[model samples]
Target: MSQRKMLQLSAGVLLFLLPWFGGLVSGELSYNFSQCLDFFYKETPPKGFHAAGYQSICQRYKNQYRFASLYHRQHRAPLYSAYRLSPTDGKRPRTSWMYEPQLVFSHASPEMEPFHIPVDQNVIDSQAVLLDYKNSNYTKGHLNPSMHQGTEEDREATFTLTNIIPQRAGSNSGPWNRLENEVLRKFKAFCNGSMYVITGAMPYTSGARWINNRVSVPEYIWSAYCCPSYSTSLPKSVKSFFPSYAAVGRNDRDSGEEIVPVNVRMKASMRGYDVRRMSVETLEGILKQRLAVTISLFQGECQ
Candidate 1:
């Protein structure tokens, strides 16, 4: 056989053997996010976040670093995903979801692999599987939305299960969706340089919620961004949003209106899933209270 054919055969054999091989320990995923620092605003990951059962994944796809995710092992979801916004004319990579191999086997390939049948038990146990969301009445929420990515591969990389959370349909398609679009508009119109975003899931302060008793569902979704370089001539209404801006959307309307109040004027379906825009500092304060931990999304507040 030719050299190419031989290499392909070897890779196939390795995939076949990976599942049955019991030698691999399903231990802690220690992969660092340093390789993908370009995704962050100042080549810096969020700081002051000290937590166990979390893995820093430098999201790799198609042999390139696309983004970074702070994945939570126990929740089977990401704490947050950070990426620099890029303009895109690409469509969503629906039905082409993938999972992180490094989460299962430490020595496995770092690239996100498309979901396949007969998924290994280790893989299912390590992170959220497709089965967890099927008929669960919750939508697969993208922490790093595909519309924010510039290239097709970058969009596809956001579909990884590690970067998803169980979200209500109302929030996914309603106010939260609008918030994402608004951010994109700001990037396209005002931002002269990189717009670094960190979107995350916020758990309820009381207790945890789950889908299929496996993947944890977030009570609220929060996002923040830092854009240091932008047009000097800005509208008064949007001027406060420059440098850094943030928002929190209601995943469960019944959860309460303290963070984001319901817009009674809207149609019934979209009324409760309100997204409240605020300053990055305000969002940080809310996150610090909810998470019981201090996390600085930008380096020296994007200094």
Candidate 2:
């Protein structure tokens, strides 16, 4: 077989083996795998977006230097992978990894075939528009980030419209953003083998339609990190991303149900470990071990 054909065949085999043989061994939650990557099952609407396959967006960066908290595709998207780029006007060059999701996807559901929509790099770079909208309308948001994409191939891949989602600016750029980056940082500390991270939004209400590009906004965002078994301890820097207590907020609205209330005072304990001092090696080790702990503070009566 030609080189391209062999590559294709290998990808096909990998995808086929995912459900039966590959996942949990990597230390990811099987439940999360089913919810995020199960392609054969079709998820129903009203839940969230689901991922189809791995995109090669971060593949190139790894070769340059080991960067923690970054994620890449474990398996190729069915036919093509998507990029997950942000709108240009929002941040210049049109990017922001500071807190927002670099890209977003359909949350794989228990009942439906996994939606593996390939990001159309050509179309994304060619047609994406950051529209000026009045309040109440959702804004285009990305799950994958353009900063992570360095080459034409990388940039183009991110342009796929499928990775787009509508998101609230405060939440998207605030706690939600913090969680996404923290996950990326955690993976950088612990995973030595290839890891997969698929994120999507869960919407609260209906009719908050996406643009003509088929891009949709998310309601609740979910992600899964697959860590490989490793022999050594993680570096200190790696531990930085894993620091406890991620805060996400919801603005007060008249009609919307306050699923996530505004600044209601929530906190978690850090066990007195200084997050900034941890090394990258330590972080990677933690991820390899799948070590993460959480505690929540609930509002009274509303709990």
Candidate 3:
């Protein structure tokens, strides 16, 4: 069926169920949205969401570092998939899977910590849905690559469709790829448990501008994640894993590659705050403060 027809049919089906399920508030109705549209549509909602103050924590933990520039929406169910971040914006959208989460270091220019965001399982096993990585000319750019999520479970979660985005193949594979690997090495040495990660892409000019809109390419990719708690001091080998926050020529414009082109800038803005190292308790406190701040910023009434 056509896109319009599918949308209309889905809408009609949803409309009929809305009132009976007590509008969007009902769990069943919410589940439908999660299964149909959410990037992270798992078999169940994430346990993280129910974790005490998770929503609040995410809202208040104002991050100085972000793993990527695009964060779309959280999965409605835990069993569905992980949240997704996308660099591109269009009505004709190409979204990544929740299953393919990649650990990305935002703000590579000032390089910081690595964040791990998992994707949904449904995004992988279910071939019924269209995945952003399947047909688009873009690479399967992971927000939290498997190499960094740590555990095998975490690594597997990276395959979900929601964690992907349209990325220039060269940028995705070269410097950007190295940065992610380096972060994983750090975690193995110093991290304790549950290191929160946030990643996304940043548009040089914000709003809904497409790749076709601007003649300029992405001058830089920003990534940062904090190791809230560490079990021990990281060794020199661990530190060695960290790449220079900036890459001079990861994108070679001379190649005239078929994929989207990322610009090669000798220098980039290294504007960002420090990736503060602290005890888990202290990190929790900081996260609470930031989450509160974010909630207030977003007009969230729940405190």
lDDT of 1: 0.79
Q: lDDT per residue, candidate 2, 1-303, as tens digits?
A: 653334333322221111211211122211122222211112101111222232322222212211111122221011112222121222224322121022223221111112234533532332232331234355445455444333543443343333445555554555555665565455455645433333433333444334443333334433333333332665664542332212222321222333333333423121111112122333223222321211111111011
Off by over 4 Å in 3: 1-137, 150-153, 206-220, 231-303
Q: What is the TM-score of each candidate against the true structure?
A: 0.88, 0.38, 0.38
Top candidate (lDDT): 1
Best by TM-score: 1
Q: Which ten residues in a row have the lowest lDDT in candidate 1?
A: 12-21
Ranking by TM-score: 1, 2, 3
Instruction: Work out candidate 1's RMSD over C-alphas.
Output: 9.1
Q: Show the lowest summed lDDT stretch of 10 residues, model 2.
A: 294-303
What's the best-to-worst order under lDDT?
A: 1, 3, 2
- 1-303 per-residue lDDT for model 3 (tens digits): 753344334422211100111112222122223332322211112111111111100110122212222122222111112232222122221323332122121211222112224323532232112332345444656656655533333344454334454456656765566665555555555656433334433222232222322111222233434443455455664542221111112222333322223333522321111122222233223323422321110001101
lDDT scores for all predictions? 0.79, 0.30, 0.31
